[model samples]
Target: MAWGANSRSSSRSSFRNSPFSDFGSYMVVKNRKLQEQFNAEASSSSNSCSNSGKPLFHGVSIFVDGFTVPSSQELRGYMLKFGGRFVNYFSRHRVTHIICSNLPDSKIKNLRSFSGGLPVVKPTWVLDSVAANKLLNWVPYQLDQLASETHNQPTLSAFFALKSCAVSVDAATRLTDQMKSEAEDPLLKGGTIKGDNLS
Candidate 1:
């Protein structure tokens, strides 16, 4: 159901539709004293996951039509069951103004139950000094781009695992022309994860 949220109904905007969808009004939190207070208040609450001011839930941008929602909801619930509280990794007490970043449009505000629920401080405060919000918004597009490229490339590594055997020409073809080169070089050059050296 669409609430008072953004109309960009794509997967990127799915959060805009939920009742708890008013994250726009929220900003990333940074004040150490405020976080400490927030943590103290929530520490007694069940299902509360305040990791010394870290938001337990790290939003991963994903897409979903109605049919895709059931699985999403199931996974969401499952994650929350395991203490998946939302977290903003850029907290200040960590000796930096920010840590890992998100998207650029990331707002710096908090949106919670203006009615009566315990207010949820947005983690934007810490996320500010970086592209964290921008990264958040960019992730989906990047993954989609990767998948599209993966579908178009050709290689042999795709078929072989660390066991040093081949799977299929189509699969391996995807490894080089499809997946590897598709990613930014810095990422590919970083380590074995991107390098075929795994096998």
Candidate 2:
């Protein structure tokens, strides 16, 4: 009856001692182990935070401006998840770091009043640190590290901002091109409806 063979003998077992059986069993065991590991890690992290009686980012306050890789809201959520605080205002006393692709011109005056240099870093500083599950040094991600700061003023570089803008433009251009191509496809062309004569 298999494939219209009309013979029982010809319909031999396709799964006889097959490797697929072993693979399926292996996958089940692997999945179980993975779930256990994840649970253990989550519990450990939670326990550590509770036992220390201090948040991971105890002394750090982060401020987000402009558009970022994970979006400002998502970035803030990540920070909050890691026991960090997000601030709306930018000040040396309040904000420890300014996370943005571009530093707003208005903030420049405020940055000048700081006693020490303000760390203006890219959003990847947050993302990478989260990925590593530890706080990372801000020097590598600082947007204004190269320029000299004599008056404790924060400096920003156009390199990361321009790159982010170019990437966004490329993505938008690609989306527009795809839409245009889909519109020009013959299968997408609407067919005319015709009425049948009943008289």
lDDT agreement with native, every candidate: 0.34, 0.64
Best by TM-score: 2
Ten-residue stretch with the least lDDT total in model 1: 106-115
Candidate 1 ranges with C-alpha deviation above 4 Å = 1-38, 48-82, 89-146, 149-199
Cα deviation of 21 in candidate 1 (Å)?
36
Candidate 1 lDDT by residue in tens digits, 130-187: 2242222322333232334447865566544633544465578877776657465655
Candidate 2 global CA lDDT score: 0.64
How large is the C-alpha RMSD of every model relative to the true structure? Answer: 23.5, 24.6
Clashing residue pairs for model 2:
none
C-alpha TM-scores of all predictions: 0.19, 0.42
Clashes of each: 40, 0
What lDDT score is found at residue 20 in candidate 2?
Answer: 47
